[model samples]
Target: MRMTALSAVLALSVTAAAQSQPAAQALLDQGKWQEAASAGAALNTSAGLTLAAEATTAGASLVPDNQKKALFQKAQDYASAAIAKDRSNADAYFELARAQGRLAQFVGVFQSLGLAKDVKANLDKALELNPKMAGGYVALGLWNATLDSGGLKGAIAVQATGASRSNVAPNFEKAISLEPNTPIHRIEYANALLLQGKKAEAAAQLDKAVAMPAVTFWEKRDLEQAKATLAKLR
Candidate 1:
């Protein structure tokens, strides 16, 4: 009788938690990142917290460089809380990795390299839990490419973090295989190719990205960036 009662309570809680998600998602779809983050976090559930983290990260991306670090830190905190609430939250892991990777750019060399390990570990965990997570693969591709592109700093980071330039193309290829319609992935691939001095190959990717129709504000922004890069290549 006690177990049955507990199960019923859990089911009710889940249903209630799910009820608020659609409205929060609507805010995200509208690009109201800060509002979405707050709305999702209000639910006080793991999924809600993860959504909050995702929104917070998106907000961070749109902010000025001087203002981004705090938002990313907030995202990391939300994602950590979500993971504490539920160990199997794949999106939470991904968001944590995303925030960490972005945060790494603002830190000292040793700190950035250390954060790279955390970023990779979280991305690995996310993919382990949800193998179809194309975004995780894309992030990994950027991780490899970025850590290996900065001359002496790049070399030191690669040696310290075990990041491999060879892994960049494979990761982006896998991401595209899993989610070919996402324009940002191609743009990211182009950026990675440019880092490799494959300007022609990168231009090819930018061309593809330019041809894709934008479905969201973020996609449109990526397309604009790609177009500018393509123009430079031309």
Candidate 2:
């Protein structure tokens, strides 16, 4: 009787946790970053940790500059925790890479150089774990394009860090193929094209991105940026 009772309790707990996941994910999808993070914090699952990491990283942009690093650090910690729980959790690795990349933005160039390796490694691992992960491809594309734009500095950095510049277009193309409806992918690819002085090609991408419907807050922000860039190009 005691064993049966315990089993029932466990089943109920599992059901409740499973139900919370959708609610947390809904918060994330809606860009309720703080609420999503808080919801994720209440759970003790890999999904919860990954959601927390994503929410924290997304929320960092809304915080004061000085608070951004700490938020990203928290995001990194949550992602690491999720990885600790499940090594095959590709989303966790992606979130870690995203957090690290965001943190790099606030640091000096030398500090950013050091973090570039880590960001690439995590992104690579995420892709290795989940080859179909379109977001990972986008991140990798951005990495390649950013390094390629640095010219001599980029060349030295690539030589020193083993970051690839040759895969920029292919990576972005792959991401776009995987998630054709995602506006950010096109926007990012447009940015990369602009870096290479392909203004006409970039404008075409921006036009597509600007026309896409943005459901999430981040997507809306990307769409706005795309519009701004397109206006300038025109």
Give candidates' CA RMSD values in order.
Answer: 2.4, 1.6
User: Residue by residue across 36-140, what tens digits does model 2's lDDT show?
Assistant: 998997797888999999999999888899899999999999999999988999999999999999988888888888888899999999999999999999899
Off by more than 4 A, model 1: 1-16
Q: Model 1 — which ten-residue stretch has the worst lDDT?
A: 215-224
lDDT, residue 81, model 1: 95
Per-residue lDDT of model 1, residues 64-153, tens digit only: 899998988999999999999999999999999998988888888789888999999999999999999999999999999988886888
What are the clashing pairs of model 2? none
Q: Give me candidate 1's TM-score against the actual structure.
A: 0.91
TM-score of each: 0.91, 0.93
Clashing pairs in 1: none
Which candidate achieves the best lDDT against the true structure?
A: 1
Which structure among the candidates has the greatest TM-score? Answer: 2
